[model samples]
Target: MVNIALGASLSTVILTVPVMEAISLYTGQPFIMAMTSVQTVMVTITLIVAAINLNDGQTNAIEGMTHFVLFATFVMLTVLGL
Candidate 1:
C-alpha cells in the first residue's frame, strides 16, 4: 500500500510536468518552479507521515480513517485546485 501510494504520488509530478510545460508554452507563464516546489512539499509531507507511522508499528481504526481522509483531501484539493 505504501509503495502504491508512493508510486501514485510520484506519477502525479511526472505527469504534471509535461502538461504544465505545455501550458507555460501556450500561456507564456513559467510554472515549473511552482510545480517543483509543490512536489517537494508533497514528498516531504509523505516522508514525515511514513516515518511517524512506521515508528509506532501500530494502526487503529482512527489511523485508517485519517489515512483515508488525507488521501481524499489530496484528491479533492487537486481536482478543485485548492
Candidate 2:
C-alpha cells in the first residue's frame, strides 16, 4: 500500500507540474500559484487521511469505500472537466 501510494503521488507530481505549466503558459496565469494550490490540497487530504487511519493501523470497510468513492470521483471530475 505504501509503495502504491508513493508511486501514485510521484506520478501525480510529475504529471501535474508540466500540465499546470503548459496551462499557465497558454493562459498567461501564474504557474507557481496553480502548482501550489494543487500541492496544498493534495497534501492536506493526505495528512487528514493519514491522521484518521493512524490509530487503528488497519483500514476498515468504510475506509475502503471512502477511498474507492473518492478515487472514482476524482476520475469522473477529471474526465468531465470539473
Candidate 3:
C-alpha cells in the first residue's frame, strides 16, 4: 500500500525481485544470473536507460522508443537462439 500511497507505478517491477528470490529458495537450485548473456546485456541497458529517463519523473517518445528498440533486439536475439 505504500506504493499506492506514494502513487508509484514501479512497485510491480520492484516486487518481482523478492518473489524471484523466494522462488529460488523454494526450488533449492538457487537462481543465478549469467553475466555473459544477451538477456543480461539487454537487462543492464534497460535498467540504465530507465534510471536515466525516469529520474526526472517524466517520459517521452524518445525514451519509449529506446525501450522498444531494446525489446525488439532482445526478441530477435532470442529467436535466433544466441
Lowest-sum lDDT 10-residue window in model 1: 34-43
What ranking emerges by lDDT with the best candidate at the front?
A: 3, 1, 2
Query: What is the lDDT for 29 in model 1?
Result: 88
In order, the Cα lDDT scores of the candidates are 0.72, 0.71, 0.82
lDDT of 2 by residue, 1-82 (tens): 9999989988888998789889989999875553344445655775687678666788888887766766676566557655
- Pairs of residues clashing in candidate 2: none
**Per-residue C-alpha lDDT of model 1 across residues 1-82, encoded as one tens digit per residue:** 9999989978887897788888989999866464445546665776677677768898778767766766776666667765
Our model 2 lands, by Cα RMSD against the true structure, at: 6.6
Shift of residue 66 alpha carbon in model 1, Å: 1.5
Winning model by lDDT: 3
- Superposed on all Cα atoms, the candidates' RMSDs to the truth, in angstroms, are 6.7, 6.6, 5.1
Which regions of candidate 2 are displaced past 4 Å?
A: 1-43
Shift in Å, residue 61, candidate 2: 1.3
For each candidate in turn, the TM-score is 0.45, 0.45, 0.65
